[model samples]
Target: MDLEKPARPPAAAPAGEGCLVVAVRVPVRIVVLVLVVPVRMAWDALVVAGRSLNDTLLRPLGRALPWVGRAVFVWPFAGLWRYVLVPSGKGLAWLGKVLVVLPAVALHRHVLTPLGRGAVWVYARVLTPVGHVLAAIGAGVRTGALWLGRCLVVVPSAWLYRWVLAPVGRAAVRCAKGLARLVETVVAGIGTGLYRGARILLVLPALAVWHRVLAPVGRVLAVVAREVGDALGHAWRVAGYVSIAVGRRLGTLLRRVFVEPARWVHRSVLTPVGHVVRDAVLRPLGDAARAVGRATRQALAAARASVRRARADLRRTLLGGQTGAERKPQLTHRREPNGPRTRTLDGSTTALTKD
Candidate 1:
């Protein structure tokens, strides 16, 4: 495998560039560079200022904003929800369940359920049978009405349509077809004439203007616009390069003038001074403070002991009774009585028998 990357081929220049484009490009680029440099520099300055503002102000404010919002907005509401509103809501829910829901459930179960059952029973038993009877009567009446209508209206209308209306309708349809044919022929001729007139009067002239005049002007304008655009882009890139060089020089100057000296002083002078202070002053002061604390604690303990003893003696003298420290603890358990020792076969005492 090759370790080095392959070099890319150079881009081919465009083939059809005219002298107009070349002529436009040079002057446009020069003008654009002059115009864009100041804008690019200002843009870079704004970018630096924005970053400094974000670092110095906005970032700290952003971090603190959440805590401030929580303190001002979230925490009080949370406290109200946790300490006040939650309990109140629970109480209200319980009250509503007891006063409203329970009674509604009971009413539904005891009264409404029975009433609905009775209504269902009535519908099933009485109203259903009555509706069926009424529906049967209505169906019989409908059958009679249909029979009367068929005899009185339907048969006559069928005969009239078949014998009287059909022949006249056929004659009228034939006349209409001839009239439509004539109208279509006339319309076709008129439409052809109009189409020819519109083409000669409007379309030809518009086509000539578009091809002869507008197109050439548009092409020239497009070429100029394209050159301008290319020039702007090229100039902008050059400005960016210039900006980067200026920024680097300024950064080097600032670093050499200020930052290096400050760093040197911090490293050489402040660090050793801080170390000396810590070792010579702070460490000794800390040691002395620890010693004093120990002495103070010991003295306080001794004083506390002396005060306790004095209090105990004064209590005993005034009350005429022993203090708790003077009292002895009584034995809680008694020793068992020993019996006479029993002799074994070798004339030695056994442990359980001796006791």
Candidate 2:
């Protein structure tokens, strides 16, 4: 018996070993794979489906549970009154009054008191100054507007008289003079024609009347009548010429005095007034408008900031991890193989071994 140290019994085949010798029929691995893969897949799918179902069903329940619990607890007190204390009409009415009173008292304490205090504080601290500033600005603007309107009215009137009415008036006067001259020329021409016609008609009538009647009379009487008629005619002609000359002179003088002075006043007073109005009234109005614009912008900016702060508060209340209802920590489970196991230094799983 070669008692060499009993050859270490061939290391026991690995735990998951197959039979050897005589061509040990290795069970077809395909069968195991087909069974195990499907079963693993089905189990994983079932686990995932179950988790999804739990999440879907429980999420809304979690959100509503607290409110439902409160309602359930409160229902008892409500039921006690309805069933025991308020079974009769009078008792029900009394219960109703109690309910109303309690709510009223609660509202007074929680809402009305705080709201009133805040309103008073705002009125005292914020509204008064704003009102005063707005009133002062309004008053200034109104006064400026009134002054500007007056200047606008007066200045335009003056300018119209000076620049537009004066020249127009002067032109009208010249046109009137030209028309008068034309009329005078036409009248003179007409008068001359009438005189020639009258001379021809009168000469025939005079010859007939004079030959028939005055020829029988003395020559001295006819000659005297003729001289008187000639003197009257000459005086009338001189008077007509003097009247036209006087009328022309008066019209020229009137136009110069009234129309020219109006033009001068418009230029001297109205133009300067318009300029002054633009500088004094319009400039201040522009400044006030700019200031109001700035104030409005500032108010808008403050309002935007306040709104942002409110939104931030809402976000923190609704979406913050610690306080929010929707944001909950997830729980996970991991399974590890049992028995003595080995792992790589990098924390990867390794095959188990038996010593």
Candidate 3:
């Protein structure tokens, strides 16, 4: 065997080094072309092609055209590129910058603008409807904000008055004194009226008239009480009868719910179906199962016997020819031997000879 070392793999390039080299070279090549032969050749080719095309096409047109017409045809395009297009492109960039600052300027102007003048102009315009909707929404928001601010300011002051500055006991005492004075004045007036009425009333005889009127009312009330009691007693008897009837009906209904029927429905609709399932389906299936079991057992027994015969045949084949050493005595001889016998290959039999 040749004892030689294996070759090693090449090392990997460093990251970004390959890309940086390519980027540097590509720009340098482009600069060289732009600054040297390619730029000169391109400029020369463009001038030559332009001159050739102008000579071939425009020379004929110029010959046929008036000078003023040609000048008019060229001047607008020339002016458009030099003035409008170039300036507009630059202005567009400037406009982009302006847009960045537009929101701040808009906010300042909107805030500083007089609301009254703006609203008058807004209402005069056809956009007044939209303006009104926006103004309404804005006013609603302003009102809500003012309300919220007022609540924020007032809630603390109210809490402070209630908790820190309120004189609860003094107010309660003043209220109680006022209420007591009002009550005492009313009671003194009533006492004065009674004092005046007592002297007049004894002379007037109003008490005797009240007594007579109350005696008649008492007799009438006794008669009304007896009538009402009798009516209520009759009502109670009717209610008791109704309750008994309802209770009997409810008991009968409950018994119907809880008790079995007086007579059962003989020969139910499912009886035939149950009989058919048991007799037709289940009986046939049971017979089939028994037959399958018997056949499977018989097949198993036959297979076992076949396996035993195959095993015997395999043993005989493996043992080769059945020599005396290989033969089983019980299988080889049908009866018992006399003493000992030997069989020769030539078919001669010899008896045992003792020494």
Candidate 4:
């Protein structure tokens, strides 16, 4: 008769847990693991023993085998090639070499070298002595000739000039001095008279004419010429300015009439025409080329794929399917662990371990 309202439905078990739960459960896999662990431990012990044996004893021999192979088998060939084969080949090569080289050496020693020696001896003994004698005789003759020229011709010429020519020259110079003194006395009187007469007759009249008449005329003419020159120069400068202005106007007119129209035609008409041609003809060509290139690449890829497939099949057949082939994406299967799978918010199934 005392019903406690069913404990008020357990008061909603708080916000985190709906109800209290307590259970003693053991998984079947855990029981299986209990049996598997002993066998697995024994197997692992055996494997560890084998690995220890391999590491301590067998792997050392494996490591040394390559070095032994190199030393025992390959080293003999290398030594033979270097010591025996190479030397034997070189010796055999000398056997053939003697055929040509011995004859050449014999010819040089017997015929050619003897002739060369005889010619050298003759040049050294006969021709060299003759050349030396000729050179000495020529040198002696040149020295004698130079001595004769100096003593015979040069000394006599100097002596004759010293005694004979110096005395005659001194006598002639004394006579010329006496004649020059008498002529100078007469010429001085006549030059003084002529100078006074010429001054009165010519110089005074010329100076009076130049100062009274020519100087004034020249000044007037200079003034008129200066004025005319200034006017002409001004006119020339104005003409030059006019010419430059006209040239600039003509240049501007020609540029507007010719260059601008040509530029406009090229910009508006020819450029568009060229672009249209390129788009029509060249663009299609370029597209076709690209398409051909793409097709070629695709064909090469397909051919390579087929070749790889053929090679894979051949290997599989030859090896009796021992060639491990990669599986396709959908055909792949994985034996999952015995753990819970949680569906993530992103809808991917993720297996959570028992940790």
Model 1 residue 115 CA deviation in Å: 18
lDDT of 2 by residue, 200-254 (tens): 8998799989898887776777788899899999989999999999999998898
RMSD list, candidates in order: 21.8, 52.1, 46.6, 31.6
Model 4: how far is 30 from its true place, Å? 94
For every model in order, what is the number of clashing pairs?
0, 0, 0, 0
lDDT of each: 0.94, 0.84, 0.80, 0.88
Pairs with steric clashes in candidate 4:
none
Per-model TM-score, in order, reads 0.46, 0.24, 0.24, 0.38
Please give the lDDT score for candidate 3: 0.80
TM-score of 4: 0.38
As a whole number from 0 to 100, the lDDT of residue 48 in candidate 1 is 100
- Cα RMSD of predicted structure 1: 21.8
